[model samples]
Target: MKLISTSNYEKLSQQAGEEIISRIKRNPTLNLGLATGSTPTGLYQELIKDHKQHKTSYKEINTFNLDEYIGISKKDRNSYHYFMCEHLFEHIDIPLDQTHIPDGTAKDLDEECSRYEQFINEHGGIDLQILGIGQNGHIGFNEPGTPFDSRTHIIDLAESTRKANSRFFESLDDVPKQAITMGIASIMDSKEIFLLVSGASKAKALATLMNGDVREDFPASALKNHGNVTIFADKDATALL
Candidate 1:
């Protein structure tokens, strides 16, 4: 595991974006695992800027999002599908058909999870996976207590997770109670992982991750077992370190 800290969130985003751009330049056909939420918004913005200024093309790139809220349609503003389109996909040159996100409204969610796992394998696994640690140390909605060996599956969003996401919804009650997320095992399959942590709210979680305790109780800690994991955190997020 490698840690890189910056003075503020903007610099952290720039550093993370530059790393992603470098990887893309090395392999234009890179399979990227993406994350949603406020933490990654800045990073996505930086990527968009690079796309506009440097013409860093994603035309040959393949992207797979980390998770999506259950019961939400792709058109729903709150859906991860819409989030990705608004934040990254629509702005990039990548073909829409090559960008994959779990169908949160699939009639048979179990089959969907299985298919998503298979789809990822068919693509030769993700080359790089982007992640954001939750205040409670959850990664890609794989909340605390989630088995480290689990695969792509549905999860009941933790109360704290839902409450934190409430800001994006009209009201707390409007937040989805469940989601389909790439399991810890699925995430670990990535050749490399980039974890972006920002804000003082995540300081405790960042501290816990850096402590090197590989316990399932703290899902993010599972990354310690991965050979190539880089953390780009802002000073506020690493203050407790």
Candidate 2:
């Protein structure tokens, strides 16, 4: 694992964007693992700007989002699918079919999970993965204490996660307590991983992860064992490190 202290949020976003740019430049069809939430919003904006200014088109890039709120319709404002297009896809050149976000309203959730994994497997796994850590060390909604051996599945949102995510909803009850997320096993399969962390609230989690041993209690700790994971942090987020 490599630790990168970014100058600021903009720099962090660019670093993350450059990761995808490098991969896209190397192979237009690079399979990308993506994350949602405020942390990655800046990175998405940067990619869109790069596409406009530098013509870094995503015409053939294959993207697989990390997670989505269960039971939320794709048209819902808070859905990951909605977030992707509103933030990045609509402004870029990525083919609609090349982007994959788990359908939140699937009638058979199990079948949806299976197909998602299969789709990724047939694509030769993710070439580059971008992640944003939950305040409790969760990644892709695989909350704290999630088994490292687990696979893609439906999971109840942790209280803290729900509370943190509630900002997007009008009320706490409006926040879906369940979500479908890509498992750590699949995330670990990526050839390269970039873990982007920011905000003062994330300080404790970041510090704990940087200081703690590799344990199941804090799922993000598992990244320490991955050979190609890079962690980028703003000064406040890395203060405890």
Candidate 3:
């Protein structure tokens, strides 16, 4: 695991975005795994700026998002689908068909999970996976206690997660209680992983990830077992380190 600490959020985003752009330049057809939430918003914005200024094209890139809220339609403003379109996809040159996100509203969710796993495999696995660690150390909604060997599947969102996400909704009741997320095993399959963490709110989690033991109780710790994992964290997020 490699760690890169930035002075602030903007530097963190720039550092992460530069690495991604570098990779995309080296491999235009890269299969990129994406994560959502506030942590990655800045990085996405930086990518948008690069697309406009440097013409770094994503036209041949294949993107697979990390998760989506269950029962939400793609058109829902709160959906990851909508979030990606608004934040990055619509602004870039990536073909809409090249981007893939799990269908959280699929009638046969179990089959959808299997299909998602199969799709990743058929694409030769993700060349690089982007991740954002939750305050509780959850990764891609794979909350604490989730088995490290699990696959893409539906999960009951943790209460703390729901509470944290409430800011995006009018009320806690409006936040979806369930989601479909790529499991720890699925994430570990990536050839390389980039974890972006920012803010004082995540300091404790970042400390734990850096100093604590690798255990299923903290899902993000699974990355320790991966051969190539880089962490781009802002000073506030690494203060506890």
Instruction: Evaluate residue 218 in candidate 3 and report its C-alpha lDDT on the 0 to 100 scale.
Output: 95
State residue 34's C-alpha deviation in candidate 3, in Å: 0.4
Model 3 alpha-carbon drift over 4 Å, by segment:
none
Tell me how far the alpha carbon of residue 22 in candidate 2 is from the true structure, in angstroms, after superposition.
Answer: 2.0
Output the better candidate (1/2) by TM-score.
1
Residue 108, model 3, lDDT: 97
Q: Please write out the lDDT profile of model 1 over residues 1-241, one tens digit for every residue.
A: 9999999999999999999999999999999999999999999999999999999999999999999999999999999999999999999899999999999999999999999999999999999999999989999999999999999999999999999999999999999999999999999999999999999999999999998699999999999999999999999998999
Query: What 10-residue stretch in candidate 1 is worst by lDDT?
Result: 208-217
The deviation in Å at residue 119 for candidate 1 is 0.2
**Tens digits of per-residue lDDT for model 2, 189-216:** 8899999999788889999988889988
lDDT of every predicted structure (CA atoms)? 0.96, 0.89, 0.96
Pairs of residues clashing in candidate 2: none
| Cα lDDT of model 3 by residue, 52-124, tens digit | 9999999999999999999989999999999999999999999999999999999999999999999999999
Ranking by lDDT: 3, 1, 2
**Over 4 Å off, model 1:** none
Off by over 4 Å in 2: none
